[model samples]
Target: MRRVPRWALLSSGCAPVVLTGGWVVAGRLEGGSYDPATQTISVLAADGAAGAWVMTAALVALGLCHLVTAWALRPAALPGRVALGCGGVAALVVALFPAPSSGGSLQHGSVAAVGFALLAVWPVLAFDPDGRAPWGLRRVPCFAATAVMGAGAVWFLIEIQGHGAIGAAERFVTFVQSVWPFMVVASCVRHKRPAESRL
Candidate 1:
């Protein structure tokens, strides 16, 4: 029942904006040849890319935002909060270990995968068994959201294996992941209660 702090709201709300804006700006800077449908965001931040700094800065900011949001999200369960924080850490690690322009980096891919899994699973871990849970934190919605993210991950993996729309799939999944925290915060704010209740 703890109300989400104003800072949490602001941080959560900015996540999607920063992430999407970063990609847009990076893509434009990289020129028309950069196909968002195929090329992944990491490419923009890869070594020797025109917008590498921009994308890297954005990613670092995004990771910090997630960390702040996780810290402020007191209504969620402890395990969920821990997972969310760890996901944020993974994001930071991803930024630290950027992939090469021509090839991949095992460390980067592993960290990205960890980040994705943590973000996707945090919702279910945060779900409250009690009926008083906020709408967004309810089991049905949380599970559905997690499922969609998982499916997106699968699609991304499939695209990676072939010359498919990896960029589009990644953008969709990451966007969803970025925006979900805002939804949960809003729900907490809306259903603000007097006591700290399980969520």
Candidate 2:
């Protein structure tokens, strides 16, 4: 297996922190006008929102982090890496096409859906065929990770349709997607072969 660069950990680890922190800070900036439980994070970045810039910046940073992580994750299959990188690009596009403050934007919604799908399926696509693959890249775990993300996506959609906790659902799924790359990097580092110990 090709070694995963040590710096991959930094990029992957920062993903979740940036995502969670972005929402929390942005929500606060929005004051009592925003109900996190009912509003999606995109609303925080929508036009005229109090913390639009902050959320937009966070989305950009998050996208860059994913792109960096994908580049450094040499141990994963090429298709998986490509998918991850594309997801990052999707994030960037979503930031560029922020939703309207008062209503939904088709472009923003489409880009976000694509990003979610890519992130959700990247785990399974990343599965290493080798029997000695790292725990995070093994077939079973990869499938499980994809399955969990898929289920989270479904829950988020249901919440969106029912006027439930859309923000909470989105946060849960996004956090899981962000943390997954970190977990994979950790597994790679922990199970590094002696020949690849330089990192």
lDDT of 2 by residue, 144-198 (tens): 9999999999999999889999988998899999999999998987876756666
Q: What is the C-alpha RMSD of each candidate to the true structure, in Å?
A: 2.8, 2.0
Question: By summed lDDT, which 10 consecutive residues of candidate 2 come out lowest?
Answer: 190-199
Task: Output the TM-score of candidate 1.
Answer: 0.95
Alpha-carbon lDDT of model 2: 0.92
* Candidate 2 deviant stretches above 4 angstroms: 194-199
TM-score of each: 0.95, 0.96
Would you list the clashing residue pairs of candidate 1? 1-197
- lDDT score of model 1? 0.88
Which residues of candidate 1, in runs, are more than 4 Å off? 194-199
What does the lDDT read for residue 10 in candidate 2?
Answer: 96
Backbone clashes (count) for model 2: 0
